[model samples]
Target: DLDDPARVLRSNPETYFKSPEEMYRLFPGREEAVERTLEIAEKCALILQDTGVHLPGFPIPELYRNADEYLERLVMEGLRERIPGAGEDVFTRAHYELDVIKRMKFSGYFLVVWDIVHAAKERGIPVGPGRGSAAGSLVCYALGITSINPMENGLLFERLLNPERVSMPDIDVDFCDERRQEVIEYVIDKYGKDNVCQIITFGRMAARAVVRDVGRVLKIPYGDVDKLAKMIPGPGVTLSKALSTVPELKERYEQDPNVRKLIDLSLSLEGLARHASTHAAGIVITPTRLLDHVPLYRTNKGEVTTQYEMKILEEIGILKIDILGLKTLSHVDKTLRLVAEHEGIDIAMEEIPLDDPKTFELLQKGQTIAVFQLESAGMRDLLKKIAPTTFGDVTAVNALYRPGPLGSDMVSDFIERKHGRKRISYEHPKLEPILRETYGVILYQEQVMQIANDLAGFTLGQADILRRAMGKKKAAVMEKQRERFIEGAVGNGIPKKKARTIFDLMAFFSGYGFNKSHSAAYAMVSMQTAYLKAHHPQAFMAAALTSDMSDTNRLVVLIDECRSLGIVLHAPDINSGGVEFGLSNGEITYGLAAIKNVGVQAVRSIVERREEGGPFKSLFDLCDRIDLRLVNRRVIENLIQSGALDSLPGNRAQKMATLERILTEAQKRQGARDRGQTFLDLLGSAGVSGEIPLEDVPEWDESLRLHKEKESLGFY
Candidate 1:
């Protein structure tokens, strides 16, 4: 009965549900099985042990006694290199951070992160300047784990690690996407493979997805189901909440019996595990075999992963780091390599002047097609409207161009004050310096903390607490902090009215304020990409095209951008271009591998043949010079249609017309050559000089030519 499809389809939460007692009646033997299971469960006892942190220790040299000592030595060395002749205040800040880190038992964590970044640098992999709140740590800066100087950037250390609220420091590292796996492999080698595994995540059915899924299982029409699903608003809206909030949906549920049935079934299935997969960036490394602590499961792809998800693993004292793969890093690295290869100049990302006028000019004009972060449509509009001339403005733009800021007058006010259309003023004189960079707009959460510290006389840590309390909107906590802030302000000679006003403003803006550390770090990346585009347009665009080679829509946009930049892109040339799009003679060349149906191996064979011998004189020359096994008729047809063979001979129509005969002749000539027969011996002539001419044919019409080009190359 359970195996019957009709009964399965008939089952629903409203009318056809089974009780536990009915299950015993449905299958009489089940009661004995249940009793036996409960007896075994009663015999078994489980205890939840408080396992301490299981982070793998960083190996230090004999000269250093512990990870803390080694971290100090490395910080001292990096301090000299990063900031020469550091002042007493810098030393004092560094020592304070180091002391806090040592006391918190996170020296090993910092050293481990430093080692990963160091390995990335040594191997020439592109890592982001910084990510998340970790950028606020001077210790991170000195160790070269992060590039931003917290003191200069006004980033607060408390935001990263509040000494009062102790938790594990999480530092998510981003690497060039193309080479991110290499770093993960390195970690696996250092820590035994048994101790390292990726974390698993479950994908739950949400409101819209559950609607469609239940509809499909019930054999409802896709269009009707899709319309019903679209009525549920966006992600994270539960079906129950949607039915209550959406008037149309509730009316339909009351009026349409089928709609109510579908939705009711969907609600039962909602939030259940739809599938399980590996986490994209989370990988755990333990001090011993991972299975000894956490149970492991093998994914369908044959990857061993933890049964517990990231949060569960964290709760059980396992260390998980997000080794995020960012494609923008790959684009930057490739652009730098292209710059060096094409024009004999060495360009380092760190050495690129952040204050380059040309870079800002390009950004201000909104020419950020391939620029990181600023390439979005809204960001581009923001850039053009703001016309940012400083790197600080770029960072502020990054922080402000979000849903919270855009939905309110925050972005408009920021723009107006930036252009002086609106006056920039603070409630109190002490708020000016803290909000000056943002034109008196509280654009960053760090600014909120700073304002609290400067005006209310709270320590940075206590200020962090106020920021959190305001962000979480806990009435009790907010009242207590308000009292503390007003009392502290009165003690510091500030009027209570002014202090209350500032606190209210902070509370209102705290919800919209962004992380300055993350904004500055990503803005630095955006600047690096913009700098390359300004100085090395051809190389940068070529690299951008190569990175997005597989994405047709992006390729079309990039090609248009190349045209706007006044860079002429020649058609793919069999003799010149390799598998990737590249720069040649101050112009971009189309990559042969970008064409549809043309494999990389086929491109490699064509390039190898052209490099070994001279350039192919004609279409026949191309077929005769290369093996037809890899570059078969389909490959040849694609190349001609894609314009890769345009330089070799007759027009696309003519080459395609005579392709079959040319391939036959080339195969015969190969057979003759294998028998040690020269052209003279095989054909009784000294050499075969020219291509065989088929009946005279006109070139493809302009419209047809462009259509074919778009078909094969993804763009005309």
Candidate 2:
């Protein structure tokens, strides 16, 4: 009977909890096993209550006796490096998670996260310091998994993981978006490529999409289908909700057989998986070749993917790593390279000082553009009034500049407090240090954790547990924690009612506390770019424009940034423009590669040929010296239309007329040279053909020329 019950628990592996009676029936009178089953169920219940409010998490499997003691041993065992003091002895919420992890046998998961993130750092890929509840972990900061000291930030580890609330840590790492692929490749190389693969996501038939698909398949009138699809409410509500609002649809379902079929089928099919695509940032690594544990499929690009979803992989103990590309890192790298070439400066972009007053002054002016994650117009407006003066301000503003805070009077309060116009009140004197930097407000998860430990005589690990109860919004657990906290505070000579009030306040905001580690990590990038914009506007803007060359709208915004900085941006110039934007004589040089129809390789070829045999004197000289096979007549026409060939043109129409003749002659000359013919000697003996007017085509008007240029080069 006990065996049957145990089998049932195993069958329901997806759910996190089981009943004591169920466990007893499965153990068949084995007292020790039966006892363990109750222990497991109790642990699962404590964590599941956490999920109902906010944390939807699965419990870690049990390994040894005594959760905290087991965690200590796991900590000792899972040190990836054997250096002295590479131990998890720190106080904070992170510590609590580590302790719980050891007892729960989830130390391997932390080690796996550490290893991948370490590799990223080694490669100088900017991994995010921490995100979500992970920032509350002191262990993460100690492990260098995060850079912001949670001890200083006052983060609660229990918010990340708790003895009572056992769940896998949802840790996301950020790398420079451009360099993110390099880290993924490294993982593939370390773990067997077959054993590592990104997670697969399914695209569902959303309300409008389902209706459209049904309409197409049913051969309904196209206009009718489009109108009906548009009539479906969007932004949040789905087709099912749309049908209720549009009584006409209801009437059609009742009155028309085909419309009824359409509506009914669409309702059933909405949200069903329509196609499978690999997760953009999620990847899982297995101990052995992935195929040994899970079935795999190949993407269109021939990349392997596990048949198991992200959760399924975790259930089986496969490690999941999110290798997110930050795109901003790519911009940084490109900017550095441009600076090296154009300014002859070996400016170590990563080594830029974090505390630059001038940079903050510019930020205070609300002059941010082409800055990672901080260029929104609304954000600019916030910065103008806030007048942030320190690295802390950047972090605070970044965290507070989101939706809820924007809607509330939070922005004005934060600004006034930071500038000293408003008094910073901690509500209690002992909590002053923790609240001082953030203007007497608990804006980070770490702060809540630190406050719990400081005032309540709780250990850092226990504080983390309290943090979780608060963050989860579990009313029962929160109520219990509140009573215990008040009792502790009263024991420590604080009023019981005041303690209760503060605990309630922590509960209100802990759910909203931004991770200081993540905010600081991102703020570092935003500031570095800001610094560059402050001092090296031309080079920074050139790189920003180059990175966004393919996107006219973004390029347009960056062009505006360049103008505000008083840096001139020249249009594409065949003679002076390099492959991408670069600074020259205090101005942003146009990128020939950005010119539409001009591929990088083709432009590169032209540049290499020019470098090898000196610059061209004219159209004839260009045709004679360069291989025009790659930059054929059409490419030439585009170049002229974009005014890239303005150095040789009467106007676009004249150059367009003569482009075919130039390419044909270049091809003939190349063919002769391949056939062992001496074109230079023949031309010299016959005397160079000159003085003849070569197709004096009419010149295009300025607007016509610009339009053609825009069409060819993808400019607007």
Candidate 3:
């Protein structure tokens, strides 16, 4: 019956809608088969075993005896370079973190991350300053795994790695999206290829999706399916919930037989795994060949992956690292390269002053079109309201612009307090120091940890646990934590009622508090992009345009931004344009590949031909010198229509008219050359040297010219 669709449908009266006699006739043996199958299933049972952590071993140099010694040596050496004038606090923190890492048996994990990140940096691939709670480690900073200084940022290492809680340290590394593959390949090479594989993820059919999918398979009308699907509200909403809460949906289900059948099928199908896909950033590295432990599968594209998902893989002792590809890293990389190439200044990203006045001015004016994490409309409006003046303001804005804080009155309160429209107050005087940087609003998870430590005398590790309990909102765990927090605060000489109130505030805010380390790291990228825009507008825009070249709508918006910035965007030129939008003489030149139907190989051939022999003197010259196979007739037509051939000796219309003659002559010349004809023979070919008369026509009107441009370039 489970395998028979007809029998399954016959079992559901709403689905079959048959009379009792017809139903019994159709499902004659269904009851006997179901009973037999249940009797057999009761005989089959299995128990799964839990295997402990299987962390991959890090390869260490023979000079070091073990991974621990190598990690310590690297951290100390990196500390010398990261902080030349090392003080007692720096050394003390580094040693303390090293102790905790060694105690937790995470020395090898740290070593592995440092090695991968170091290789990326050595190869000049742009790596983010840091990501997630990993930035809250002084060891990560010193080892060059993360760039954010935890001490200066007031980030606690225990928040990242709790001594009281034993778990795998998660260090998610971000690389430039363009070069992320290269970093992955490097890791695959360092670790044996067979030992590493991307983890598999399953996509489930959520409530609304299942409804529409079942409706289509059931051959229902499109309008009805869409109407039913719309009735399911919110993310992850179930059909049962929708039927109970939505009056209209309930009415339709109760009254319409078809609606009832659809809802029943959707409820049965929802939350079932529909498809398998590779997790974007989850890659697991095993100590030995991967197949020895976990079963493996091949994706449709032939990439090896584990059959187990991330949670199962971790439960069985595999190390999974999130190697995220961030587009902003690519933007920063391209902007820096452009700055060095055009302005003759090689600016180190780390050395740029974080307090640049012009960057703050740009942020204050809300002109952040391409700034990382700050380009959204809501963030821009928040920027205008707050008028940020310092790096801290930028970090605060990044944290507070999210849904939870924004949906509540927290965002408005933060803005008002920062602007002095509202007074900053704290429930307890001890909370003043903790919330001073955020203008007395609980904006970061780190503040929650700080409040627990200062007021309640809980250690940072226990505070992190409290923060987690609040975030998860586990009833039993939260209740236990609440009691402990109140007791601890009372022991520190605070009134019990005041302690309870503070704990409640902490619990409420912890639900939505942003990770301070992550905010600071992301804010650094935002600030870098903003600084480049303020100091080098043309370079920044050109890079930004190149990054989003494939998105036509985005291109239009960026082009408008370019115009507003008083930066001129020149049309594509065969003689000058590269494969990507580039800055030339303070103007942005459209890339040849940005035009429709023009591929990268074609552009490369054109650019190489131009470089080998100087710029094409005419249309005939371009055809004669370049390989026709790559830049064929169709490509030439696009180039001309998109105005890339504007620098040649004719108007677009004239060039269009003369294209056939030019191609015929060039083809004849190319064939002769291919046949080993002498240079004289090629020059003596018919119509090769003489001027080909074109059908003279008036130049296209501005509207027509722009129309052609839009058709070929996807934007005018």
Worst 10 residues of 1 by lDDT: 682-691
TM-score of 2: 0.77
**Model 1 C-alpha lDDT versus the unseen true structure:** 0.87
* lDDT: worst 10-residue window of model 3: 1-10
Model 1, which residues run further than 4 Å from truth? 1-45, 219-221, 255-258, 668-696
Clashing residue pairs, backbone N/CA/C < 3 A, model 3: 53-317, 54-317
Which candidate ranks first by lDDT, i.e. highest? Answer: 3
Per-residue error (Å), model 2, residue 104: 6.2
State TM-scores per candidate.
0.91, 0.77, 0.92
List model 3 lDDT by residue over 1-716, tens digit each. Answer: 34236763435536754654565576887766544655798879755666566777887899999888998998899889998899999999999889889988889889889889989999999888898999899999988888878888878898678988888888999999999999899989988899998999999999999998988888889899999899889896788999999999999999999888888988888899999999999999988899868899999999999999988887776888999999988887888899899999898887777899999999999999999999888889999999998888998999988889988999889889998999999888999988999999998999999999998899899999989989999999999999998999999888999999999999889877999999998888889889999999999999999888878889888999999999999988999999999988999988888888888899999999999999988888898888998889989989989999999888999989888987888888889889999878876534446345555877899999999888888887
Which candidate order results from sorting by TM-score in descending order?
3, 1, 2
Best-to-worst lDDT order = 3, 1, 2
| Each model's total of backbone clashes | 0, 19, 2
Could you tell me the lDDT of residue 541 within candidate 3?
Answer: 93
- Better by lDDT, candidate 3 or 1: 3
For model 1 the TM-score comes to 0.91
lDDT pick, better of 2 and 3:
3
